[model samples]
Target: MKKIEAFVRHESFDAIRARLADMGLPSMSISEVKGSGRQGGYTESYRGAKTTIFMRPKLKLEMVVNDADVERAVDVILELAHTGEPGDGKIFIIPVEDTVRVRTGERGEIVLASHPDDA
Candidate 1:
């Protein structure tokens, strides 16, 4: 299994989720995060004064998918999140050694594939 973590713009999050749902990839973890990458942070006007924000607001999306689906998932994120500008965000792919369902105690892919509607 592979874990896909994507840090995307706040405004694009809703569209990203909707598109993922359409692709049967609704299960995910999302959080409001703040960070900076290559372009670094930016300056904004605060009460008519220039203020630098080192960490900007972003949406962190995380989900696990089969190896075969990695490319598709990445593509979805890229297509939706791309803004042709800085702070567009980044995606990270990591290896997931294992997973266990708390209630059923099922392991690995079995746990991942068991959606609530099927239970």
Candidate 2:
């Protein structure tokens, strides 16, 4: 299995989620996160003053998929998340050693197949 972690712009989450749902891979963990990247954070003005937000708000999405589906999931994220600009975010793919379902004590790829509605 592979774990795909993508940090994307806050505004792009809805579209990304919708596309994933359309592909029968809607199961994921999402969180509102803040961090700086290669371009760093930009400056903003308020009350005639300018300030730098070192950490900008972003949406972090994490999904675990079968080894063969890793590229498919990554492609979905890249297609929706790219804005042709900086701070667009990053994606990390990692190996998942195993999985255990708390309720049934299921393990391995079988654990993922338990959800018929998801891929």
Give the true-structure RMSD of model 2.
Answer: 2.1
* lDDT (C-alpha, whole model) for all candidates: 0.88, 0.86
Please write out the lDDT profile of model 1 over residues 3-116, one tens digit for every residue. 999999989999999998887788799999888887755799988999887988889999998777789989999999998998899999999999888887888876666376
State the lDDT of candidate 2 residue by residue for 11-84, as single tens digits.
88999899877876777999998888877557899998999879888899999988877888899899889999
| Model 2 alpha-carbon drift over 4 Å, by segment | 117-119
Best by lDDT: 1
In model 2, state the lDDT of residue 68: 73
Cα RMSD (Å) per model? 1.9, 2.1
C-alpha lDDT (0 to 100) for residue 10 of candidate 2? 84
What residue pairs clash in candidate 2, if any at all?
A: none
Give the C-alpha miss distance for residue 48 in model 2, angstroms.
4.2
- Native-referenced Cα lDDT, model 1: 0.88
